[model samples]
Target: MKNSITPSVPARGPADHEVRDQIVAAATEHFSRYGYEKTTVSDLAKAIGFSKAYIYKFFESKQAIGEMICANCLQEIEREVRTAVAEADLPPEKLRRVFKVFTEASLKLFFRDRKLYDIAASAATENWQAVQAYEARVRTLLREVLQEGRQSGDFERKTPLDETATAIYLVLRPYLNPLLLQYNRDTTDVAPAQLSSLVLRSLSP
Candidate 1:
């Protein structure tokens, strides 16, 4: 298969490493219930029935655990987008379908792990490094996609592709805003597909 723009994070070990996953699951719960600010190693260890020092053996701090949780969530989004783009089967339309693919993935990411999303948002609002890196990667991906669209005459925006992409990101950002998720809480109003369609059609020639 051809190389794709999927996000990959540092791998720890195997799928059968039950103990590591137990920590991750415990961290996920703690981060969800208490959020980044309030979640502590002792709390996570207590939740998992592990020792505080044992938690340290796997993760040095809450921030490190937060990174693993957020990284796992982001990785899921990347996999979905990669599958959509890879299976579109038409290079000409691959560029256009990427929007749908990415949007679909975003919806899944949003709904599949609201708790982790909340934790990530709390960290992001605090200006965490992993969140900043994810944001930059998002912008970079948008810039590249927009540039491709321009080259193929799919979009007519005259500004530099990166600037244009940034503008578009600003416009469509609220749909994925974590605050909105807090309000909706039930996932009834956020329609990532419709949002993606609106964006894709807006740029269609």
Candidate 2:
């Protein structure tokens, strides 16, 4: 039998980060239109005028690309949340506005672009570091709000800050979580304002 040799893959260079970003952007567009399950490395490469081999040089798999996209989306959400937190004065007001901003953004992003949301939700289950970091940032923001509320005599101090933040997250999860929001929309008739009021009441001093 004749011996066969595998061709060498291109080495990553200083430009790899830029190229990787380009690949991620193209992947985002394709995933948005066709969805994560349907979008493939081939589609991404073709869209970017590159080859599948080149894409593999930067990303190990399509899932990796999806993870990057999810991270980007979460980072965007975090920025919006931080802005909402900075602008509000009182803890209750901060909590309410933060919750409103997050829920509104979630609904707009998930419903308008469900495919990307689905990919993000799936990536979250795998506990990607980006997702974990984004989650931590949210928790910290919530804890800060709670601490401020306690100091200002706005929120009851019976519960620990961590516990209060956790409770608030859980209570509003159906609205914050993409999958849960989808389920809630399909299964129930409760409105976002109603849910907001219920959560705010629990935080009262």
Candidate 3:
């Protein structure tokens, strides 16, 4: 019988969140530079001076790291939208500001980094739950804004709050979708101001 070879596992490092943070930071650079499909655990480990096993200790897989980066990016987007919504007094103004903030931030985040955009695009298709969860958060934010509009007598809704929010989200899909944003760079079919007017009119009492 032939002798079997055993693979050696990397020794564990300090069991602190710092190690995880380092992994994520290094992974972000590698992912942004090399695109998601080309990046590997070994590449990340080599960049960080750790073994692939060490990376696995912090993140279950390369996909998990990608998910973390996506989550972080989405969180930042959410924070900007939330800040804009919170500061605006009028619901129409809040909706407009939120739309502007979301569009500007997303464009800056994705278009400025094509590799990141590619990763996000892949995640939207493959890791759909992450995308859905992010959308759910946005929908909840929209619902809150709609509720405020209703309370302020700015909106006369024939549909329920959740349904109305979903409708708004679907209506704004072209603007909110990253892939569509990338493809429609030169297109002038729908302007931001035009969409804002449509949304305001739709919501008006």
RMSD of 2: 10.4
lDDT of 1 by residue, 11-125 (tens): 3455346777788887787777776667677877888899988777766677777777776776566566556655754333554454555555556676665566676576556
Considering lDDT, which of the candidate structures 1 and 2 is the better prediction for this target? 2
Better of 1 and 2 by TM-score: 2
Q: Which residue ranges in model 3 land beyond 4 Å of their true spot?
A: 1-16, 187-190
Ten contiguous residues with the weakest lDDT in model 3: 1-10
Q: How well is each residue in 1-205 modelled by candidate 2, as lDDT tens digits?
A: 1112211122244444788888888888888888888777887788779999988888788877777777777766666777876787777777877677777777776678877876877865677666666666677777888888889897888988898788777766777666677777643334546655777787787
lDDT: which candidate is best? 3
Give candidate 2's error at residue 33 in angstroms.
Answer: 2.3
User: Model 3, 1-205: lDDT tens per residue?
Assistant: 1112121112234435788778878888888888888877888788879999767777777877777777778777777778877788898888787667777777778788888887788777684455667787778878888888888899987778888898878766556667777775554244556777888898878
Query: What value of lDDT does candidate 2 attain over all alpha carbons?
Result: 0.72
Give all candidates' CA lDDT scores. Answer: 0.62, 0.72, 0.74
Error of 1 at 59 (Å): 2.4
lDDT of 3: 0.74
Poorest 10 consecutive residues by lDDT, candidate 1? 1-10
Off by over 4 Å in 2: 1-16, 124-127, 186-192
Candidate 1 TM-score over all chains jointly: 0.67
